[model samples]
Target: MTPEEWQAVLLSLRVAFFATLVSLPFGILVAMALARWRFPGRQILNGLVHLPLILPPVVTGYLLLLTFGRRGTVGQWLAELGIIFAFNWTGAVLAAAVMAFPLLVRAIRLSLEAVDPGLEAAAGTLGASPIWVFATVTLPMILPGIIAGAVLAFAKAMGEFGATITFVANIPGQTQTLPSAIYALLQVPGGEERAMRLVVIAIAVAMSALLLSEWVSRAIARRIAS
Candidate 1:
């Protein structure tokens, strides 16, 4: 791959990594809530969480632009604090996170739903706090699912283009990720070969993440079984 291609791949990895990492805690919390609790506006919250999946990518991007653009209400405040998202690499990360979040939440929520409440209750009866019960009894059992979710989100982030480009634009070495770079490459003559190379890289990276997630899950399963 050319240096620019390599740069795009690296930047993509960085954006996807941060996107997954930054959203993980919130994913877990929201998943747990939807799986274990009953509350008013729960459906509303769930709908909002999954809205990105339902909306057109361009629409999601536009909404993000309105919310996170430098002159936007939240964006203006954030910029005042030295944070910017619009037209930046961070915008790519945010776009990826928003697009990938629904998948992550669904995976974790399924795992949480499948867990036996009896186990958590048993832990609680032993004088464990709710947090302790979750940490000691629930989290370990659901770890494999969390890994799977993160891997899924990472893959999604790796391929995110529409929303990312809409929010951040295709700025080489700054916001151009693998998908955007590939798109840009395809726009000109003699660019198919480079675009194909990027496609391969994307596939390789996504497959690697899945394999790693599987390996870790199997290891955890073995340890738990032992």
Candidate 2:
């Protein structure tokens, strides 16, 4: 592989890693809330969380550009903190995180919903605090789901192009993920072979993520069953 291709691969991995890591805690919290809590505007919050899944990727990216773009409201405030998202690698991470969030939340929520509340109540009766019970019991029981959600998010992040490109234009060695790299290669004359190689790489990454998720799910299930 060329140096540029290698750089794109490494950058994609870095962005996806950070995106998944940063979103995990928030995704778990939101999933738990949506699964177990009932409050005003819950439905609205759920809808908003999932809106990105339904919206056009370009539209979502544009909205992020508007809200988190340097000249935009929140973007300006963040810019003052020496954080510029637009046209940068951080923007790519943000776009990937946003695009993957819905899948992560849904996987976690399903797992959370499947957990028995009676177990929680039992723990509470045993003098276990809510936080303690969640940390020990609830979290362990739902480990498989968390892994699954993370894998799903990682896969989604790997394939994220529309939102990522729209938010952070394909800059070599920076925001150029495998998918974006493939797209760029496709646009160039006599670049089909390189594009094909990248396409294969993308497929391999996605398949590995899925296989890893399955393995994790099975391991967790076995542990839980034991």
Which candidate leads the pack in lDDT? 1
Pairs that clash in candidate 2:
none
Q: 182, model 2: CA deviation in Å?
A: 0.4
lDDT of each: 0.94, 0.92
TM-score of each: 0.98, 0.98
Off by over 4 Å in 2: none
Q: Put down candidate 1 lDDT per residue, 103-171, tens digits, no spaces.
A: 999999998988999999999889999999999988988998999999999999999988998888999
lDDT (tens digit, per residue) of candidate 2 on 1-226:
9999998988898889889999999999999889989999999999999999999999999999999998889999999999999999999999999999999999999989888999989999999999999998899888889999999999999889999998888999878988899999999999999888888888898899999889989987887679
